[model samples]
Target: MQNILFRLGFLACFCSSAFSGVTYPPITIDLQNKPPGHQITEFRTLTILIDTRIDVININAGVGFFLIQVHSYMGNITLSDDSDAQISGTNIGLIWKGNSENVAHFYLFRDHLALLDNITMLIAVSTYSKYDPVPGGCNLSFETEIAPYQKISESDDFITVISQPPSQFGNFCNRSNIVTRMYYLYLSEHDNSTEQYFANIQKMISVDDIVKYGTLVLEGLTANRFKQMYSRYAGTGRVFAAVSTRLGRSAAYVPAVSYGCDVAAWDADCSGPGKDIFSFISGLAFALLWLFLWRKFGIPVVAVQLAFLLNGLLVASILFYSQLGDIYIFANDATFWTCFVCLLIVTQKPFGCLTSLFYIIALSLVGSYAVIFAVNYYVGGNLPYILLNTYRRITVANFGSAVIAPPYQTMDICQTGLWVLIFCIGVYVQTRSSMGRPPFPPRRADRARARVDENTPLIEPNQEMPPAYFEAVYS
Candidate 1:
């Protein structure tokens, strides 16, 4: 115990040096007119000294999770703190938030604006346009709060996002007497209202942390930056939050009830004492990403990375194997979150030499999906319907079921499916550009040179080549 305390002291000292204080710089987001919406209102401060990068400990009051959103940057990030984690070797479902083998916790995800670097990635997703275009440049909207989901977390029902501290020393969910500092997210009008319902569980966070030291990335991303993030963690989903806005006047923060993974609704009317509608779409999005990675990265690396990316889950599976049969969908998001981060940092350049086919297959799916999803967001209520509607989930959940009420007056599932098929063509086109290309090959000469560095036997051309050549000629 003394040694453990000593280690804790050492860690705290190290963190104090590394991320102790905060002086986060404000990033700028350039939107065409009307940057501030009605949703950017009210303020409830959180802690500043916690970290939500790798380990996700628990989902309790004010300690396990927190949401950091910035409209100016087009980012919707969720930081989880689980001291305990676990993973498995399965391909269909791997890492999860808790100990359940079948479930995974949903970590936070963000989608940055497309124009940040002005360089379009050659991804092939079917949900978005093949050549989906946005503004020429991108900027982080520091003043805006685009996600409404971040708001509904202050309080509510079956889906409780723990706000106060936990009770037990190790029990992060029970303590409520303490207060700290970190990042805080406000709400906005032109944002994904559904996200407001998704839980932004945290322990203790404050605005001072970001306000004090978070550096503003002003130069914009270069190809090198993308390469670095990609090579390390190349993945299938959009990884940045493009904007944020908080509106206090309209929506009141109310906790909603939940039955299993499904959020409790008043009467399936899609309204009443519930949260934002953005969550369903966001959930669908990350799911699409998971599918894309499987198709692209293949199974080997995916398994290895998932094991590390979701260590908490691996721990849980080992300890909770007996209770595996019963777990919530919320417990399954951990693997999804791992896949989420993997999507951000994994890139194509690394595998370009190892295998081009894999890269082509992976990027083709992701690129197509991204293009189509973006197109759906832009269409507003004009084009909608499932099995084809680009933003079908959003429209269906928000308005009604597509089976009953289609978005447009005259578009059946078949007609919408045609457009979806058309969008898929664009995905194929972009994928053709991104796929089926040959990866880099290791040359014999290069290998020989590298071997020389390792004190390996040299196969000199002058000595070995002549004999081999003579043997070949004679033979």
Candidate 2:
């Protein structure tokens, strides 16, 4: 009877050991501020003190190797005998206690688990802030080498892990949703190719899986925060398209969202209207200059014609290139064409130097006032002012919607005033020079010389007999 009791007691003890599971304490290590090239030798090890059997030991170093073990909870089956085993590349070794009843300790030695491809290892040990709370009772480190692990979804009590990779690990412990933010960690692995990285992203976006994941957030990785972020992810048009479609208009990390429009569109809107005004002002100024040159220096009609023809060719070339290449060159062509047309009209009619000068001054004054009126009209919320209307029609007829009215802020009123002053001064200088010059040359001496008649016969030096005949010839 005593022997029977001893056997029953031993069986009860064995059952208790089998049912109990090992619980590890919460650990957080912060390696974010660690200096580059610094090596870490010691880690806060997880030790098993009880005489409990370690059914399975799982270690995921992220990229080098993947080991999976499956065992039925109802049966005592061994999935893998990792005891006394060492993993290559990582140089990871497991130490078991004497008699092989329990695991003694687990540790990372030298640079064994220091780095991995596509996996960024960060230690946030015992660090707390208003934003991030401590993850409780979890000793294992997290890795995102697999595409599915790239996103973490949040709920009230737990967070779901999803990725493009086949393996599916259910919910992770998040007792109170302590980790409210998502961090995109980038690991620099020389052997890792960007092709696979982009492929994973493409797969995730195709199924619309990223949208189901909670809000995606990224911390600044460099000094140029926006530029870096843009270059890293948003630079890809496919990624941008996915982000825009999934998040609607509320998504973060999109460079276009920060501004009202994309870079090219914003530039066009800001410079469009201003370009129109500038072209008009340029035309007016050129007309004034043409008048001054003709009235003051007397530029010949042929010279004026040649200048216009050359200018027209140049403007045409600019337009052609703008159509074939960049749209910005349209501004230059518009300005040139406007000026060319103004000059052409003035030169078309035959006018004397004085008449042309006065006409140019009058035209410039009227053009300046017209500009002020057009600016005021546009500024006052009027659609299609005279100048803008004419410019828009021309641009649309030629370049489609490649050019439009620029924003009001781009107009330079002071510049217009300066050009007008220059025109007025030019006119004044020409007037003064013209007034200073004599209308015709003096002819007093020429009139006296004309009185001697060449037709009269010359008298011989020896003969002086024909005085009355010489007087008659002189008269």
Candidate 3:
């Protein structure tokens, strides 16, 4: 009996060893570069081979089990298997079946470590069977270390980075916080390649152990290039703010927000509060020139009409290039229809120029308000919707670096000023041409009577002509 028991025990041990699956070694993921931490700018993806399990036994039993559990303080996490199957939830249970053996592959996606100093990820795996439970079930576990650099400050245009001093080191040895501020400037002539752009960024932070700031001016970059750079480095914990200049107003600052990149406190259309004084001046000059040509050389009506059409087309083209085509088209149509109806009403009347000028001014005012209302409604009551949409579309379309919104306020002010100036010119012409006479020319009969009276000379008081002579003279 003792010999038989011994042989049975030996057989059981041999069967257990034969049925067991291959066990994978613990996975050690080192994210440390020169920084000694998993310092990531945007996001990271990791894949690990968990284990190789024999499915023949489970396939016959019609029961199998695979499980993975991840614990981390990272921003967000996603897990998947080698078969492109998404494992849902933090504690995941993976199902497996079939006659062949299979390897369990796990993938992980980690979010940005915006403000954290360090993050740890722990992964645990276990597999089992519902029936014919195998003695000594296999369980494996591993841990991944992630050290995220702390963010100092951030804006739409740039982000600042600084190393956190050790908690135990007290304030005495904690060298001045390595504060590095990066500024982004969009200039008219700066066009930097991707490598050059990144090199420039790195140069700003190259100085050792000192508080420093650097400016990166991107000039004339295509929209795609600009957006690429903006997205790549926007969240890297290095940029501070991107600043833009206007003709009359103070610099507009764009800060990065969690929702997306945007200009803070500024209209999406870049239509700030102040008038575009330069545009206004230019419009006034053009109107004065037009008035001079009209008064001095008597410009033809057809020529005037053509000029108006050309001006409209030019303005529309400008708006289209500036991504404000919709607004411009709306305003132009409204102005045109309004002026057309008003001109028709006064077509037969004299002083057409003066009447047309009045119509232009009134239409301009009405059109301005109409544009504002339409834009507001389209933007869902947000005044800056144009500017915001402009940025978003450009970025998404990969034209952000190349395309930019013109100063909408300036365009509006200049357009209105041009109409007002034309009106003023009309007033001046009327005043100068009809200063000492009636506004309308005298009738032919009146002119003839005046001439006869002048020729008679002093006949009113002393000399009285005969009735027949007077009748002949008047006739």
**The candidate that achieves the highest TM-score relative to the unseen native structure:** 3
lDDT of 1 by residue, 163-278 (tens): 11112122222212322211222222112222331212110011222233221222211211111110000010011111111121111111111121212232232222223469
TM-score-wise, the better of 1 and 2 is 2
Candidate 1 local lDDT, residue 353: 55
- In candidate 1, residue 288 scores what lDDT? 89
- Provide the lDDT at 293 for model 1: 69
Query: lDDT tens string, model 3, 110-213?
Result: 34333233334444332323321111111111111111112233334322322222111111222223221224322111122233333333322221211234
Ranking by TM-score: 3, 2, 1
The candidate maximizing lDDT is 3
- Candidate RMSDs in Å, in order, are 27.0, 24.6, 22.8
Task: Please give, for residues 280-381, the per-residue lDDT of candidate 2 as tens digits.
Answer: 788799879866765554534544454444433333332332222223332355554665465545544443455545444544444444545565434422
After aligning candidate 1 to the native by TM-score, how far in Å is the CA of 35 from where it should be?
55
TM-score of 2: 0.21
Which parts of model 3 are misplaced by more than 4 Å? 1-255, 258-274, 301-306, 311-475
TM-score of 1: 0.19
Per-candidate Cα lDDT values, in order, are: 0.26, 0.30, 0.33
Q: List the lowest-lDDT window of 10 residues for candidate 3.
A: 139-148
TM-score of 3: 0.23
Worst 10 residues of 1 by lDDT: 228-237
